[model samples]
Structure formats: structure tokens, C-alpha cells
Target: ENIYLNGAILGMRKREINRKFDEIVDFSGCARYIDTPVKRYSSGMTVRLGFAVAAFLEPEILVVDEVLAVGDAEFQKKAIGKMQDVSRNEGRTVLFVSHNMAAVRKLCNKGILLENGQLFASGEVSDILSLYQTRSIEKIKSKKIIENEKLGNAEFRVLSIDAISPEGSVLSIESGVKIQLEFENNIENKNIAISIFIVTLEDLILFEAPIIFSSDNNSQKGKYLIEWDIQPFLLNSGTYKINLLVGESQKYIVYKKDDILTFEIENALFDQGLNLNRLPGVMRPKVDFKISSL
Candidate 1:
């Protein structure tokens, strides 16, 4: 089966592919799909079939990506169990990549943290997670505003930016929070457009807010405070950064900053054994699920 998948790369014949396919089928307990077309396979079946084929190859080292995320819960459990067995009994090395923190904690003994496409740190899984959490909290709590006069043009410059809590206290990732951006416009009566981005630790953008200046209004030159109210925010528990851009229009940029601000959301406990922090993905909006026996 391994040869069947790698036929194009290894330059194998049809007979060789079928021979290995039968062996993998017997080993993987996938006899039912012995003659099924690979293109017709569903996402979960494809992932399982790929893993099964790779496992049967008996290689000294295995590399895996997020394919395990495609399968159903039961299939995911089976795949993880098989990996554990392979690593423990067969003494084969497995490199698993995933954004599911809980699964990583359960499956791997060691972990590595990557920042900006570079190796940041490597240690025990718990220590790595602790390090990530601590650094995120410290970075966000210590910053009030990022003064970057160089990024601003003659018309406008950023003075400070900060996140505020709903109860007029320190910023906390609870329910209601607002982000305040302070800027000074030296030239008055000019329309300024502001673009804001909320990005994840992995540099993935989660949300964007744009402010378009109105031509109908005229204002004097002074400092301006722009607020972004995030009520009923659905972001998952993690560290995030904010990117800001100010310009005359969306096309022309006057000031731009990347990863200017940082914040962390603590784990939130919900009913029915649900932890907001433990959930996978960038955001977890409130969802309604219905279940009943058919």
C-alpha cells in the first residue's frame, strides 16, 4: 500500500502496487475497501487509508501533518493509539504536527515552540506550554501604547494603543473589552482611514476592522481616540497580536505596524466539561448543537 501511494515518486509498476495494497489491507483491517477507488474516498477515509498505508511501511521514521484532524472522533482516537503503539513497541520515530494542543499534550512527550518560522524553544510538553503562556501574558500586560513616530507621515502619527476592560479596569479577556487607538493628526480637515487586524500567534488573521473617513465632516487638528468594542467575542483562549494601518485611503498607506500589540485569553470553563482554552482552532463562536436518537 505504501508503494501504491508512492508509485509516482518511486516509479513502481501496477502489479507491485496491487501486491503491496493487499498486504496493507490485511494489516490495517481495511479489507472492505480493497477495490474502492481512491478518488471516491471521503476526507476521513482518505486520512485513515493514508495513515494505515504509512504505518504498514515499517519505516524507521514517520512524518505526519494535520491529516489526523480530518477523521471523526473515533477514527482520530484509533490513529493516535496506533501511533503510540508504533512508537513504543516498534521503536520507530514519529513526527506529528498539529494545532490541537490537547492532542499534542496527550500524544507527545516533548514539544517545540516555533516563532516567525524559526525555532524558539524545545523542552518537555508542559514546560513548553507554560513558557508560551507566561511569555504571552507578560508581553500583553506590559504594553500600553507603541510609540512609532517613524511609521507616521507628516499628517498623522500613532501616540498610543491599549486594550481596556469593560468595567473600567485592567484589560481581561472575559466578555466585554475594547481596544483604544490613540493618534495625533497634525494636518486638520483631512479624512484618514484606519485599518486594524487581530492576528493569532501563528500569524493568522482572525478578524479585521476598518474605519473609513467621511468627507461630509470637517474636524480640527488634534489627538483622536478610536475604540473597538468587542462584545460577545468568540476568540479562543490563546495569545494574539494586533496590526494597524493608517492612510488617506485603503490603497495609500501612511503608517503601518505589524504585531504592535499583544493579548492573552485565559482558559474559560463552561458547562458540560467544555474548556474554551482547550478547544482547537483560532476562534470558537457560540454554537448550537442538537442530538437525538433517530
Candidate 2:
């Protein structure tokens, strides 16, 4: 009833409200509680109902500000789909405000980045998202150790992790990056295996490198330094974080740390002809392409 009343107040005719009532209820997933009072609804339920009412009313413009953050994942997806339908098929305007870069990138064509109540940048969504990610990476303080807790019987202790370019300068897409890891081994007899995970800012694990122990020298009880080199043109231009894990041959994990180091890979200055703008995927590998006049 409140949904219908709100629809009426928003200039929706009775016939129009009746036509879209089922859809609004179904979309919000609040059919069971349709008869219940709005005061008894949970925060998420309220948000869902409100959004459903506003969206189904078919207004000229819709303003949503972080409302989808309250609902569950399924509801959020449906809401985003509805918004897309409204904007594309119905030719309506949706003024969405959210800090979710991934969602913004998916829904919006243009982006406006605001900093300290002032307009920072407004342009293509991808470019704005890249700039936003780079700015976020810049704010992360580079720390030596993220957590002080000893992991797994104190057998292995991570000392430091560093991400540096081959020339020991700022990282770029064209630079071959090196990951240096220093750790202290407490056990002598047991073999230790180290794995490094390259994760995006969105918490997606792109790929992992596992350094397995094959010799007795590597299992010695002492401080050790290991370096992993990532060739140029392997990773795309984005902010990435490192997750470290030290264990013994898939048996058990001794030490595990997330976000031990955060680094940004800037776009290469040189042009690659047709591939000018940043590629879509997480990786931009250098693959051999043989073009023939066939």
C-alpha cells in the first residue's frame, strides 16, 4: 500500500501503478512482507522497497546514492540491471553516486571524480577509474610488516617484501618488475615452500607464483632472500597488492599475509599502435602474433 501511495505521490497513475505493482514487488523480493507495515521493515528491506517504488514509478530522473550497498548481492545485481534498463531502453536519466569503482565502471559511461567537495576529474569511466585507483594506491603507506602475529608454530617469519623495477625506479607497464622477499627460517629438517599472489585492488587473485623447495640448502635454518622477476608487458596498468604464503609442500601453511605490499603499474609512455587505451583485462601479456596476407 505504501509503495502504491508513494507511486501516486510521485505522479504515477493508478492504472500505471497497478500495471507495475507485481514487478515492483518481485524485483524487491518483498512480496511476503507486502502487507507488513513499513515501520516493521529492516533497513535493507526498506531500502529495497524504496528503490523498487522509485524505480517502478518511471520518473524522468532517478537519483541513487549508495543505496545498493545496503541490499544483498542478488538484489544489488537486479537493481543495477533495472537501472540499466531504465537508462537504455526507457531513455531515462540515472544520477548514481557510489564509491564502488567496479560497479561504476560497469554502469556509467561518464565519470566524475570528486575530491574534498570539489570537481577533480570528469571524463571516460575507465580513465577516471584508473586515476582513482592510482590516487588510492598513492595514499596507502608502504609498511615493512603489516601484522606482528607469528603464524603456524613460528617456523617461518617474514622479514620484508619489496616491489621494485629493474632500474630501481618507479614502476611502469614496460618495466620488468622484481619482487624481493626476505624471511627467517626456524626449522632445518622440514622443507619450506613460498607462494606469492598478485591480487587486484578489487580483491581478485590474478595469478600466483609458487617457489617449491627441491634442495636441502633452501631448507636450512637461517635468513634467506628470494627474488621473483615479472617480465615486461605481463601485467596491465593498475594498482596491485601482494599476498604471501609460506608452507610445506601443500601439507600445511606456516605463514600467510595479505596486502604485504601494494604497488602501482603506470601505463607505458610508448605507443603500441592500435592498442592505445588501457586493455580491458587484468593482464596485458606480450604474445607473439604472426599476421599473414591470407
Candidate 3:
């Protein structure tokens, strides 16, 4: 029995995992292929078709690259949902790669990180994402310079975005803490817009604000200044980050600052336990307990 188990092409595995389902399915000989291959399609079309077909094919193992970005916004959501369905219902494995850290955290329970053509880390997706964000932020800070050239095929360099906090202040309680974002830009062409974001340490974007200095169908030029006051900065005791953005409003992207800047939030102590709720689990949303019976 052991010899047969170890030394066989079966090898306790099969190439077509959906074979059982296929046998039970009523094909009715509807499967056929046209030999004339489609040699051309816009990147968006290709993604729509590819993701749709792969969703239906239901392979044992699925691998998706960054090609998901090729589709439009609506299609991207569909593709993600499809991939998730395949993994959960079909009990299959999926390998996905993306620069969108938020999406990675949402879709994957496991992660593989690569840095400089080498394996940096591989484990729980949250841990890997945290490490990746840390590394990216460190590199961004080291440069001490942020450059932006995606403003309508022209250069718009952002010199700095300075984050500020007073001593012993809960961010949520303090309604209006002055946060400064300093920039150095020629701003010679107002063909595009500039945007900025305030992200939490966990990469949650708390706020995103944009500044458009051009109007009346013409280009404006010069250095720029942008400042804002935080309102009800509802972040629990933890570190937060600053993320900068620049591009068209609909299809905007990362600008000079390729990573996040860190700032710590201080919270006053209560009767609750440490780091989280005394009861259990990983979160501590404000709540009150009441005893009741039905």
C-alpha cells in the first residue's frame, strides 16, 4: 500500500481539480474553440475578458499579476470579487501581486514580499504589508526630496509636507491642530490637479484633499502653499502617516513622496485593559454593556 502511494503518477494529486464537477456537469457538447486567435485588444478589454474567463475556468491554483489595473474601476471590483469566490467556494489557492496595499490586505491571508530581486519576507499578509510600508517610508525619508512629473506630462516637484503635533494631545479631542504641507513646485502648467492625503499607521487614509490653482482654460505658474486644520481627528492611540498625491482627479496617483511619514498619537488611560478591550479580540470600538433576556 505504501509503495503504490509513493511511486505513482497519481502522487495523491490530479492536474484537473474540477474533474469531478465536470463529469457530473451536462456539457451537451457545447465546448469548441475557434483557431483564429484575437491578436489585438485594448489593455482594458483584455483584462475584462481574461478575468472573466479565468473566473469560470475554475483551476486548482490561480495566479494573478498586477494586470488587474488594466480594467476600469467597476471591472476591478468584479475581478477581485471573482478571485475571492474561487478561493472560498472552490477551495483553491490564489497568488496575487499588487502595489495597492489596501487591496492586498483585503484579499490575501498570506503574502510574499520581494525587495531588490530577493525574497524579503513571506507570511501573514498583515505583517508583510506592515514591513513593506515601513521600508518604503524609510526610503522616502532618506531622499529628503520629493519629485512629481505626472502632472500632465510635465514636472511638478513637491519639496516637503511637514506634519505637526503638540505634546500630550489626543488627536480626536483636538478639533483643529495645524498641519502643514510645504511644497516646492514650478506650477507652470495648471493642466492637472495636485492632491494630498493623511493616512493612519495601518495605511488607512483618514483624509484626502486637493488643490487646483488653475482656471479659465489657461495655465498658471509659480511655487505653491497649502495648509489645513484637522477637524475631529478621530484616531485611537497609535501612529499616523502622511501620503502625498498628484495627477488627474479620476486617475490620480503617487507623487514625490512615494511612502508615508510617521506621527504618534497619545491617548489617556482608562479602566480598560492594555492595547485593546479587556474582553477579547483585536479591536476596542466604544461600547457599553447591558444585561438583557429574551
Stretches of candidate 3 off by over 4 Å are 1-37, 145-161, 166-177, 181-196, 199-227, 235-294
On TM-score, the leading prediction is 2
TM-scores, all candidates, are 0.56, 0.69, 0.57
Cα RMSD (Å) per model? 8.8, 5.0, 8.7
Residue lDDT tens for model 3, 98-119 = 8877678788999999988899
**How many clashes does each candidate structure show, in the order listed?**
1, 0, 1
lDDT of 2 by residue, 1-294 (tens): 898799888988999999999989999999999999999999999999999999989899998889778989999999999999999999999988988767888899988899999999999988888888777666554333324444234788777678999888778888978999878888677767889999988777988998875456657778888999998888998779999888876788777877778988888747857567767888887878898997
Residue 134 in model 2: lDDT? 76
Clashing pairs in 2: none
Model 3 is weakest, by summed lDDT over 10 consecutive residues, at: 26-35
Residue 35 of model 3: what lDDT? 21
Q: Which run of 10 residues does model 2 get worst, by summed lDDT?
A: 143-152
Q: What is the per-residue lDDT of model 1 for residues 1-294, given as tens digits with 9 covering 90 to 100?
A: 334756534455677566677666654445787577877777667767777777656667777788667867776877788789888888998888887666676788888888889999999987987787676656654543334445466777777777666677544334555789888777565666787899876556878888865455544577888899876447666677889877774557777888777866655435466533466666657767999999
Which candidate leads the pack in lDDT? 2
Q: How well does candidate 2 match the true structure in TM-score terms? A: 0.69
